[model samples]
Target: MARDEGGATDSPAAAYVFRVTVRIDPEVEGVWTEPDTFETTVVRAADSPGDPGWLYFRDNLWRGECGDEAHMRAVAEDALGMPVDAIDFRELRTTQAYLDDLRAAMADDLVEFNAETVDAALSKYLGSSIHVTDDI
Candidate 1:
């Protein structure tokens, strides 16, 4: 006989089910930090003791001296030790993003960036020295 789809049944063979969704922006850089990237993931679950389907999404963003996409890809690959395709750069844009991925880096007491060091990196692309005077 077919089972009823109404209220929960006390049948021993029956099982509960559920679903889940997760959006992750794998912050590649510090929050409000230049040249940042991210990736998102979604998943579904069921308590019926059976496997559930999985979904994944990815996005990479960046700002300031927009590095070559190829170079960025290589950096990501080396850092993650994964395939190049896995690094999704679809959402990458030269703009500031409102994310808190850099909290650790900023809060860390050991991490320090002086004006000279910052200028050198910027000078490589900006053709001139720059200072990290901005709070962002």
Candidate 2:
């Protein structure tokens, strides 16, 4: 199991957290109003076991407000220099799901890490790819 900073195991039902970074094109006009990167958490529904149902900040820290799909669309559009309609954010996966995929990619070799579990294997595979939110 994955342990938190306090050394307790992370809840299987807890939200998946991600730190998103988008590079802003300097050619855009006017002063830059937003940071280059932001973090958000996706909460999976208990009944829906496969993926998360909503994306929002743990607190109202994202631009002084919590966000949903609509807000993410606007942020991605501005950051990526594209129209909101042209952007797609469907690929964002939950942390557990991501780890499962990684383990699957390993195939039979995953047996070696079975004792430690897929989460440990994923942590080793993704070394530095994992990021934490600064707000919480």
Candidate 3:
């Protein structure tokens, strides 16, 4: 990692948390295999620049939290190896430097995201859910 005059490293760092709730539908599968709705965590490591992480807004996000719960459920199932019925987005805890990199990356491809600006793209997907944290 390269450092500037102030000795601040340029590498971007961030972390994301997705809170998931799931249960087998008692009506569909019968009560034989059933567990009440419960919360769990699904880990999706932040992808590199070329991955275009912002696409969730253009293609997935429904309101501002999670647009495609099914997709999230699939992700959790893959991670936990269990059937998941629901997924919820809590917040993206990140460092300011990481956000700057995200903004820069988004600015490079506005049309692909169907966003007039980077902030718009971020807001559409993340909403007011970003929490800038000092701790990585």
Candidate 4:
């Protein structure tokens, strides 16, 4: 039932689109000449009803060509500036899955608004993985 920063009572979730780039560490020389990168989107409940605010990211996730757990950990640790063990990664939900979750999470809100309208708003970003952070 929360509202977005735009003061729209219908839009209760805030969404973010990120371009994630994973690359091999330059120090490790290998046949792999390119870095792996992907785009991801995350959405979270607005801080307060009618509070319009969102965060942005600059750097991308980078890794080395080794393709080992240690190497992957190094890339995440370096890019995130946090211990590898501390980071938690979760699989994103599909559009249908997200909609189902949203419906469950916002059951009360749905009673106040039309479910179809909410689905339409969220449908535009289908197929993108979502990461729900604690900040939400």
Candidate 5:
């Protein structure tokens, strides 16, 4: 959502931002010893799940979300331009309508996801990282 100079929030955006925070061990010499973190916000249109542009989300989501920790960390590191030591899939900021539409689309394509239901498909891919909100 956009906010005017009056400090009031506006309507939600048409796309969603997947914000992921990562902790990195700084390589700088003698400047710091503790780890630092940065968040990367990846924006994607609130399009139908069938759209080709949504492939990146499907491609990066592992069946077992935490099975490949290194792979997940790499994704965050690539986006943040730093070697990430840890990752936290913050949230998917979106509107209620977009989320409902996505779930409906997923429900219709359960076969493609190899799951009996839409929720199962979502869990297989995103785990518990999804958080729908109008504050996008």
Candidate 6:
């Protein structure tokens, strides 16, 4: 987890909640029994709001965890309207950053009207579709 110049969390430092839908590989029956969900945190420099810590998984493995990163990325990309490479992963506070971003993005005037709409709007403005999820 990278620290900001102020020796604290950065501007985009927030928790982003993502509903990951794991698609089990047909080759491996019940390889993952259920859809394990989790969140990732991202910290960005207050000055450099666009460059935030991103999260990524390789070979379907995590940081010694059960949840998959690819699933999370897919969901996020769908919501954010951007590529997976756009999101940075932070080690110090992944969950916290994710939640913070989620709250900030959703905490808008239209949140009460529809959560999906807010998400879509955020994705469009933020230029990241990785936060969106399918209607599963």
Query: What would you estimate as the lDDT of candidate 5?
Result: 0.61
TM-score of 2: 0.22
- List TM-scores for all candidates, in order: 0.21, 0.22, 0.70, 0.25, 0.59, 0.21
Q: Compared with the true structure, what per-residue lDDT tens digits does model 5 show for residues 16-63? A: 344566566656876664436666665545444566655444556644
Superposed by TM-score, candidate 4 places the C-alpha of residue 52 at a distance from the truth, in angstroms, of 18
Distance from true location, Cα of 62 in model 6, Å:
29
Which of 2 and 6 is ahead in TM-score? Answer: 2
Q: Can you list the residue pairs that collide in candidate 3?
A: 61-67, 62-67
- Model 3: residues with Cα > 4 Å off, grouped in runs: 1-12, 22-37, 51-59
Report the poorest 10 consecutive residues by lDDT, candidate 5: 10-19
Put down candidate 6 lDDT per residue, 39-79, tens digits, no spaces.
34432222211233222221222332324556656755666
Off by over 4 Å in 4: 1-21, 28-99, 110-116, 127-136
lDDT of 4 at 93: 25
Strongest candidate by TM-score: 3
Estimate candidate 3's RMSD in Å.
7.6
Most lDDT-accurate candidate: 3
> Relative to the unseen true structure, what is the C-alpha lDDT of residue 40 in candidate 3, on a scale of 0 to 100?
81
Give the per-residue lDDT of model 4 (tens digit) for 12-90. 3333332233443445666444433333333223232223321111011112112244654565557554444322223
Across 1-136, the per-residue lDDT of candidate 3 in tens digits comes to 4699999866436655688776644556435553566778764545555575644434655445777777877877888766677788777777887788778888998886778998888887788877787764
lDDT of 2 by residue, 1-136 (tens): 4788999864443233333444444567875646644444333212122234321222112222223546665665665454343222222233555334434644546564443655554444333333322221
TM-score between model 4 and native: 0.25
Ten contiguous residues minimizing lDDT sum, candidate 6: 44-53
